[model samples]
Target chain A: MSATSPSRSEQVPLAESAPREARESAAPAWRRSPPRWHGVAEALIKTTALVAIVAIVLIFVFIAAETLPLFTSHEVRAEVTPSTMAWKQTWGEAAARWSWQPASEIPKYSIAPLIIGSLKITVVAVLVGAPLGILAAIFTSQVAPRWLREILKPTIELLAGIPSVVIGVFALLVMATWTHRLFGLEHRLNAVVAGCALSLTIIPLVFTLAEDALSSVPKSFADASLALGASKMHTVLHVMVPAALPGIAAGVVLGFGRALGETMIVVMASGNAALVSWSLGVSTRTITATIAQEMAEVVHGSPHYVVLFALGAVLLLFAFATNVLAMRIVESFRRKRGGS
Target chain B: MATIEPSQRSPGGEPRAAVLTAAPSPKLEVRGLDVFYRGEKGGETHALQDVTVDVFPREVLALIGPSGCGKSTFLRVLNRMNDTIPGARVAGKVLLEGEDILAKDYDVVTLRRRVGMVFQRPQPFPKSIFDNVAYGLRAHGLADKREITRRVEQALGRAALWDEVKDRLDAAALGLSGGQAQRLCIARALAVEPEVLLLDEPTSAPDPIATAKLEELIAELKADLTIVIVTHSMQQAARVSQRTAFFYMGRLIEVGATKQMFTRPRETRTEDYITGRFG
Candidate 1:
């Protein structure tokens, strides 16, 4: 460093004696002026974000507007009132009051069977998906070798890249026969098969979110645990898992919402039966499936069309609620961490 | 080396018969330890080069050095914590009571239990204060609730933290002040009843008052437990340790009694560093 200083000093006067114009021209032109595209890029990104938020709000407004006729229009109300949809109707003494035969002569519209079916399939999906995803995430983040994790993480996430329709077709054709042979189910396509297939879709979503959370836990925490003589398994299970609980919970809630609103998978594999039975082997139809199956064929302004929109409105509200709840949980957990 | 009388060393501390003998057998005998880390540039960075030190029983041995001088690395060598780093390589022997802890088949879990560590930053588990102290006990299969509670209180008391945190044992450990949290970490390590405790710049994160409190705790703790502390502060080494080791560029420059090393350091580099000539 010292040896170069004399040579550097010897050249300073010669370089500085050059004209100011020459020095100015020597530097690159782009370095002298700010690029014009930077501001435009920022504005584009901001507008895109704003447009996304506004579009979501607009969609909810449109769906809610469509459901408004159920309360206001007499023609739509004659077939399905909010009260009639929720409560038992007197179709006949023999006919089931809590049925959903929308195309029958009486066109019964009790949503109980659809609600029960949605709950049953969603519950099954969450039960199967949450643990599998969480455990897989734990393995990838905490236990798996680096090479194995490199292979496993992308492969598991590849499940998400597969179109839900393809998964539905697989369930409808291949899984239907497998379930019938393995469990001897009464229906070849039942709630269990559809729920299991639905779980396959959520596993990747939950695993990605959960693995990110687990990986983000500070290394210091693990160091402290291990330095206390705790085994690797004990350190991960006790310390890392609890630290990442909020994120894991958010993943599970998002998976639940996805299962609730999923259309193609449930529609193709659930046998389209609106049964209120608690049996997993029986066929069922979720509200999402109901809307998807009926929306195209129904008359645009008919009671059935409005009823389907109302179910859509309900599904939309649930998705919104689940998102808000997950956000709240994550926010509260972050605040707690920051405060402590 | 000057041999101070045992009575003058620590008035009411643990017996120095094991430490003050003519040729004292080291509680931790590290011989020619070398650590190499694989750098991002695909080169082997020699972190510690042919370093050897002896930590006698019931003594506070302070390792003082500048940043990246291998003091912290030497401390981690006691418990084999360097094994966690992916590209870290260790050579030479770290013998604990004549048994080579660097052996291929050495059980790191057992080694860590016998030689506990407190990090530079206080990292309490995301658990209640009581649970933080009880983590090791439970990990090692001490299942009785009353026994855990009793041991937790005892360990906290040893760390000089029980009186402050006793009433709110259920409160999150992270809620404590930096000093209290560090003491809580000490308590957590103490709960395991390790013979040697390794502190790697433990006072660097806390405030001056906290540093003083920790220094005082070290004085009290050395009554029974052997301590190896790595610190950047020369004054802290002079105050808290019985013997001080000065390290520079991953080499042990000097090791002697704190009084002698600080007042009349034999090595020019050690004297220059202590006098703030260069880090």
Candidate 2:
């Protein structure tokens, strides 16, 4: 290189010229030039994103301000009144009990059963959805033929656009009867039914994401494995699968979040019996279902309405946590790749 | 070489395996090998045609030609990597260890294992150095964990990388210097223990020093493994290979011992190519 080129110091100065160019480009904005409409348009293209974020923050501030009064004024509880049925007035009241019911002019709030029911359905949904969806992704990415994969992928993703109410209807009419007949389930709107219906929604989400992850795996790794005399399946199982773990985890978490927030399917199919039972065949209710069912009946400014908002807060926190965890997993994977 | 999966029936819907042998009957034998692509224009475009060559064991054969000469395409035929290409077809025969690789009765998985390939770029797995070396072993289930660890050490040592990376086995492979990454790739191939290693311009992506180091490593590897190196750089072929074959317009112009082919040419095209004339 020295024989055919200038001295290394000359090259160093040439490199230094780059930083000088950067400085030249960094002059103060006002002195550079007055902006035109197109320039403003271009800047708007970038700032549109910033504006959207500010909009979101404004909405969040509004929600927080409106919701703050309830938390500050009173511990959430049912107000005893001259009535015939029991009902919980606030989420804080509901949260403090193991079971909730509004009966015969008396309103009592207990949300433990609803919380437990939500946990049951989400757990069941995740357990069934994650593995099946990931496995679908693995087969599509690693094993399926190119033409078949192209056709199958979009068809699977089409599930995402299906109306949630249709899925619920399908679950309620067809699947519920099948479950009751096959397994002799006592409750048609059981956790099992909700989980299966939710799994349908979850599959497409996880598959698209997980397939992308698996597809991004370097071909060299596959070649190296195959050259090692490993069977194609073996290669997929041992190398490709593990390498795509972060992506698979991301897909699963995203799927879980969608399932947790799902309302129509759970509302219609889940028995809405706040009774918490570990058996999948038994009746259950998710937080989403509880909110959906009670939202209409609760007075607009009542503590019960505020309690529902609190539930919304809880659900949002869960979804946010899942997304953050997935981001961390992906970030760690990228960092490891970078360090290597 | 690592042992091939014991021949077993694939559950319906998968292509059957092709038998691969690495006893070095002709390190590679080709007769009337042709590749064609069905273009969107609905016409067939031949990539390689009527190609024929016999590579001897323990010898380095270089394929040099103009761009799109199908030199790399023919090189990939050694392991049937072309099989992955859609609408790409290989007619005629490629014989390894006196067996017909194109025959439907053959096992492709087993065949690929016998004929390993290194791509033009050094693409290491997104894994730690130790895991990268261990990947082949684990994927094939060729050995237990204890044994795999041993082979990882041995393969890295053979690639001359153990010293630099011994203390940092857990370092990601992507972090390695260019030379190290290429060697790591070579180590991965070595871990697989293929009898034949097909390299498609192994050092093309590296610096001069790294390229030289790779040349040295190839010299060492050729002592034990049959190497078919495809290089566009004539200097590289002159320095590293035992035999040289020039390819032009998807055809093999000549094949002879490297020194004789370079110094004493039989084909005019080969002579022109080596002397820096039109391909």
List each model's interface RMSD.
1.8, 2.4
How well does candidate 1 match the true structure in TM-score terms?
0.89
* Reference-based TM-score, model 2: 0.84
lDDT of 2 by residue, B1-279 (tens): 121221331321112111112333456667667888778778988888777666667778788888898999998778877766667887877778768888878887777767878887777777788888887677665668788888889999888888989999998888998889888888887887888989998888749988887898889988888999999899999998877778888776777767888888878888888898875
Highest TM-score: give the candidate number. 1
Q: lDDT scores for all predictions? A: 0.88, 0.77
lDDT of 1 by residue, A1-340 (tens): 9997876676576468878776566544675555789989999999999999999899988998999999999999878899888976675668546789889898888888898999899989999998999999999999998899999999999999999999999999999999999999989989999999999989998999899999999999999999999999999988999899888999999999999989899999999899879999999999999998899899998999999999998787778888999899888876655443
Quote the positional error of residue B2 for candidate 2 in Å: 37
Using Cα atoms, each model's DockQ against the true complex is 0.47, 0.40
> For candidate 2, what is the DockQ?
0.40
lDDT of 2 by residue, A200-270 (tens): 99989999999998999887777666655668788788778878888888888888888989999999999
Which RMSD does model 2 reach against the true structure? 8.4
Query: What is the alpha-carbon lDDT for the whole of candidate 2?
Result: 0.77
Q: Clash pairs of candidate 1? A: none
